[model samples]
Target: MKYLALWFFIIGVVLIVFIQFITSQNVKRLTEGNKRLLAEVAIQNRLRLLQNDVLTVESDIRGVVITDDRTHLSNVNDKIESIRREVSALRTDLRGEHAETYITELDTQVGRKIVFSQAILNAYDSKGKEAGEAVINTGRGKVLRDSIVQAVHQLDSIRQYRLNGIISNIENNGARARFMGVGLAIIACLACVLAFLYVVNKGRQQERMIQMLNESEKRIKEGAFIKEQFLANMSHEIRTPMNAILGFTNLLRRSSLTQQQQQYVDYIYSSSQNLLTLINDILDLSKIEAGMMHIEQTPFSLNGLVSSVQVMFADKAQQKGLQLTINVDPSTHDTLSGDPVRLTQVLINLLSNAIKFTERGFVHFEVRCLSQTDDEVVLQFRIKDSGVGIAPEKRKAIFERFQQAEAETTRKFGGTGLGLAIVKQLVDLQGGTIHVESEVGKGSEFIVRLPFRPIQNHTEAFAAPAEAVLNPVRGMRILVAEDNQMNQQLIRHLMRQWQMDHVMVSTGREAVEALRREPFTAVLMDIQMPEMDGYDATQAIRGELRSDVPIIAMTAHAMTGEKERCLSFGMNDYISKPLKEAELYAILQAYFRTADAQPAPAVVNLQYLRELSLGDTEFENAIVRQFIVQVPEELGLLQEAVQAGNKGQIKSIAHGMKSSVAYLGLTERLSPFLHRMEVEAVSGTDENHFQEDYEEVRRVCEQAVIEARALLSTSA
Candidate 1:
């Protein structure tokens, strides 16, 4: 088609050039014809003047003969000279076969006439009027005059014939030019029509393509909408039953069972947890893509947050016989104001991948303080694993959603590949950064840096005492509205264990009816129900009954804004199932504030001591006793240094306690606390986090003493 258009364009240009050429030829011929005709007209005018001069000369001669007037003969010579000049003009202008002959004859005859006239004038002067009259009467002058006239007429005829020929040639050229110009112009117009038709055809094809694209885009958008709806419904449906499964799994883990049964339950629990993580990651990726995920700046302990992440993968590392170590820098702030939940997710996802990939080597985690100010601190989290490293070519692909190092990676090491993507999103949303360094078949290290506002002058809102188990809401009236029988059973077991006064209902309608009948301290409202949903029931309880009871929303739809949604609809608090027992109790205690439940002791791991002993009981006993003695005393001195604000003493004591903490395998436990103390003392940033870390360390160390004493006595 393009070639065809080019040919058409070339033809149109050629036709236009041809038309211009025809017009130019016509102009050139007409110009030549006009020049020839003008020259011929000049010849005719000269000939006419010559003819008039000839007549005047003859008339002067005859007048001289008749009147004998010499005065008339005075200008006769001038007339003869004029006749000679006209003959010369005819000779110069004439051009044809007979043009020279005619000019010569006319010139000869005019010369003879001029000479004869001169002779007549001479005769009149010399012999008088009678002799001149006799010379004129012989009729010789008349013959000469007639001869000159005849020659002038022959020249006029020759010129007139040449003029007619010039006109005829000009007419022929103009007709030819017109014929060629009109034909070429018609062809040029046809070329234009062809070009126009080609353009119109191409335009229609383009229009059809555009319409087809629009229809395809509409279908794609519809498919995307359907996919989004499917994901929402899928998440809601799976979480509903998975909540019950996880809840009962928790309940099962706490029950006494045989060793093989315990292992099976552990497998079930881990599998369920992995499935839950996948769901959470998928939803997080969805939320991040949809621009619905947000970061929250809430005050939390940085050390406590990472410590939990370290513990999460500790067992997996041990099961694989890998050394798992997590360290926090001494100068890093412990209590910071940031998104604890997001930070937790980022760390867990990274460290979990580290352990999952490391089969026979060590997995390490390190948190270091990169920068600090009076009110803010930047912390760097470095997670390094000696695992099957990433290929250099595929390094960037790992962070994209549903992608990994390669296809083999997803096949061998199972993942949805959304972990890193989610981590990347969370870090970016919170105004932080993350990057990776890896070498194929060697190891990989992921570095993440995040900013947090330091929480100064910490105050504990609630504290669980380390004494005895005591119910916060024993005999308190609590109403439960749940539809799932298994979840209801799980809640029943927990309530029975809490020894709380509670009643359970299967539907929101029944719960509302029960609430209308009597007063309850709190209502645990499940969002999804058969008869009436939790939203409508809460509306009834608030709008119709006009009650101010505390309604804690228990639901399975664990998206980003689930809590806000529940609270927006007149609910007092929010929780999701399968619910954690501690969270539920904490919620109740927040309302009642009457719990004396004992805080669980941090289980002391003597793995390092055992490895150091090499089956020497005495050495083991001595180290345990030494740990029990030195930890408390040094903790006291460290407390004094912190209290006195002595930076040097604080550093000296914290640095000196590392080996002792490691001997009992409590480096993860005491290191961050000591690290925070030394930092606050030296850097002079904030003392609140230092104090909080110290208090936590004191409680843990004190509990360690009791556990160690019990162990030593049992070994004895």
Candidate 2:
């Protein structure tokens, strides 16, 4: 459009110039004609003057008749010469035919008229009687005047014609210029319209693309949320059954079972292990999808890891009558640090897949050292099997989760097909690469290259050995505060198997009451119970009891933060259930060993001391004396609260007493009866409630007296 406008401006300028040129040319021609006309008018005037001069000369010669007229005739002749010179100049200046012819005719007529006038003057001078006749014969002067006027008229007509032509040319050129300008403007408008439409279309396309992107992002977020929820629920569902199976299997191991029963248990255990692995894989997939997966760096022995993998799969390969070989390059480092767990997972998946697909041929694992630096070592792991290989089309597709090379292969191999996918993700996360080379019915080789940094200080990497057998729990009395009947029974049975005595309570209230009345080694506190959860109960026990008793947390929720939350609430240790007997025993042994080393005070009845005592009289005597010194103040508060009839204060004091007595394992002697008293005090059932609690307290005091007497008798 700009270009067109420029062109129109140029054309307009050109037309203006052309108009000026043509007008100038026509004006020049008209000016020349006007000049000619003016010259003709001057010539005519001169001719008239000459004619008058000749007539006057004729009159002087005819009328005066030479008395004394010599000077007058001479003046007349000079005048006649000047007029002829003026007419000659006019004739010399003429150019065009009209002007030339007019000038020539004028000159001829003038000259003839002058001659005729001179003849008349001569006749008047020489023959005075013939002067009139000479004037009549001379018509040339009048004819010359008429010819000059005709030439002036013709010049005016030509000038007018040139002026009209110039004006017409200017009007024609301006019209053409206006037409060109309009055409150019139309073209520019069209171009602008097209540009605007193009821009609008492009903008629409970009806007549509942006809208699509926003929708896609929204859908992705929604899908991710749904996936996270599903994974959480699925993990819960799978882990619940899995916990029961694994927990019961562990329990069964302690029982005196026949070989057949043991085999059955083993089958269940192995199946549970496999199921747990599958669940873990699914959880991993969910983490990956949710962008929550994280990499952890740890030090591990590369040689030991590879050897373990070989040991795990070699037997399986042999069972299938396939040869399996694991070869590590001599140059490979024995110890390299990395995410050993993830690395092992990937390698196991690769090797397992290799073993699974191989029918008769050998499956080989070759570990080669690529390079080494101060911090990082590069290694290549290749698992090659001469077996039914993946087809060319299916090779890449096999890396997608839940997709195998063929459905038939999936059925025969019996896998979730998530292994390779997980392997790929893990390898990539480690900043490594994996590729597969395969041909159908020939073989497949999966190659992995990894970089790992070794631990800087090897001495710091050593971990103490775990004990093979647990220490025995002697006849220690334990307090079990579990609300569920079955769970309470389970704990009771577990404690009995360890030859330990325990007091079972249904609620935090009952537990506190029992703790006040009896002495036990430690408390097994459940985290989730009605009216009071474990956290609140532990806080109460810690605050009211004022004892650093070991409170092991037992809960079903095994979520990530549950353990920390449990410990943060004053639990000495945390265990998730379905509980493992060994884990529970370990916690018990930890607290019990410390408790046994410190004898209870003398306020605890001698009978309760005897139950906890290991035939050590000095130890028993020392603990009884300590208990005797501490229990009075605590018992005094309980008695005061009971007298005041403040149920809350009573419960608090009784709770403290219960924890102290339970820790001394006096539950069988003191807990049940004190618990009954506490139930009456809190229930406020009747005036007899306080009386009954008082009676129970009196009975406990009498038992303590009897136990103290027995102890003194034994010592004597």
Candidate 3:
């Protein structure tokens, strides 16, 4: 290898020397040729200028003679001076050339021409038009100008001949240089080929090593990609069951239970919530590492955001027996355009860390407008905790992934050490800066500065009332396509609680089939399912079924783009797994309350009956008895439709009797089933299985009629 390298270097040096010699020779010749050509061009240009100047003087002299204008005399005098300067310039430029001889002769002729022109101008000035005309008629000025013009032409011709010679020489020199360069290039290329052979033999070992390194790098990248995919899948898998646990726990908390059981449930809820937080931290870290995390800028309320964060940590702070303080500057605008979600995420991570590390002392959070301009607002957030502070050396590493103040800190605190890491990444994504200051055994303070654009003509965001009265529209039926048994049960239980009529399906295929068979007010779709996924199902519902039914994506995948992916596939909105009761209720309220469909009036309009009766008890009783008799037959028909798998008939009967059911004040309980029957009838799916709900509706309706009859009797 050493011998080959030595040989390659020797050949390379020789090749370079040969090529450089040839290139230098060509460059020198081209440079000399360019200089001579420029000189010839300059001489020829001067001769042309002198000729034009003399012609102008002659024309001006004639103009003075003919027009007898003093202005013409001034023009002639000016041109003569210009001719003199041009002649002097030509004399200087053509000093050693053949044009030098003609330049002197040309200079003399130009002087004589100027003398005659001035004589004509003087004639016009001192004598008059007659004398000037007499001088011009004599033809002395014309003769001198003609002589100068001829001399100028001779000079130009001589320069042209010189230029032609220079160009011919340049062409000859270039051709010779090119021929010589070609010969040298051939020799250089031969030497290069031999050098290349020597280098190739030596470089084989290095190339093999480089190839191995590249393969190693590729494997590392693939491993990282696989790890990210595994984490994403694990996130979905874990969130699925976690959702069920938390969702069921929320349901259980609302039910009647013993004090001990309730306490146990609370513990379970808190532990589950913590587990969810840990999972989220891992997923966020994975995304940030994979470069998949993005910051979204949307309009949000600053006051609301801060208050919500305060509320979130308030419980934990109380449990830890530490005071938590949140102070917001009044000067901060309530509405600003920014990624409030990411901002909130970063703040929560910082606050949680602060609260967790601090056991005895208080944790203080403060937000103030550091600066405000017409378009942007810079907010300064400081989270100071009077807990165990970090040592000076460890402060910098705390924000790194999977790092804490020290290894012991992670063991003592029982955290993933990813909070600050995520916090730092999120702040950077938002074009913000975050820093921490700490002294061991005292405390730590984390400060973040973020800039956000101010929202123009922004309306303050209002939180829904805690106990929002949900007057669910009558006959509002929704379709839920959930594959998980627990999730399906959770949704069913919630739907019943809200008195919302809905049908449950196990797959996207079923959801699509159901939609085609019947009309639903909305569809709650789970993303991952058998037979078909939620995205394809939504597309089918939108295209094949041409149904504009709002499809809310219930997904466990909490990746950054999950919501947009669902929305792109025609989902109206989305809610992540382990859905919160408030979010579900809010979604329902937003969908149903805003629907143009009005609520069916309460059971039995007493006012209508009173007006019809005209204070007659017998007429009201007869009316109640007739309604009772007709309802039994309609109920039997509904049962028959369910038995025969006649969805159309069942829907027709449900819609026909909905008014009477409303009149009996049974719409709240019976209306849900009636709405369900109406929706299922259109779906034409598993009609026989729907009898259970139909039977329940029957029982409620019968009991309602009985209660109504007693009311009628008493009122009469």
Scored by lDDT, the top model is 1
lDDT of 2 at 654: 51
Kindly indicate the candidate among 1 and 2 with the higher TM-score: 1
**Which candidate's TM-score is highest?**
1
Candidate 2: minimum summed lDDT over ten consecutive residues — where? 458-467
What's model 2's lDDT at 68? Answer: 35
What TM-score fits each model?
A: 0.61, 0.49, 0.54
lDDT of 2 by residue, 466-539 (tens): 11222223666788887766566567667777788788886777776777787677788876577876788888
> Residue 352: error of model 1 in Å?
3.4
Which stretches of candidate 2 lie above 4 Å from their native place? Answer: 1-179, 190-216, 295-324, 330-338, 358-362, 370-378, 386-394, 428-432, 438-443, 451-716
Locate the minimum summed-lDDT window of 10 residues in model 3: 458-467
| Predicted candidate 3 versus true structure: per-residue lDDT over 417-459, tens digit per residue | 8888899888998999999999987899999999998754312
Q: Model 2 residue 410 lDDT?
A: 64
For candidate 1, the per-residue lDDT at 28 reads 89
For each of the candidates, give the backbone clash count.
Answer: 0, 28, 7
* RMSD of candidates 1 onward, in order: 14.6, 22.5, 22.2
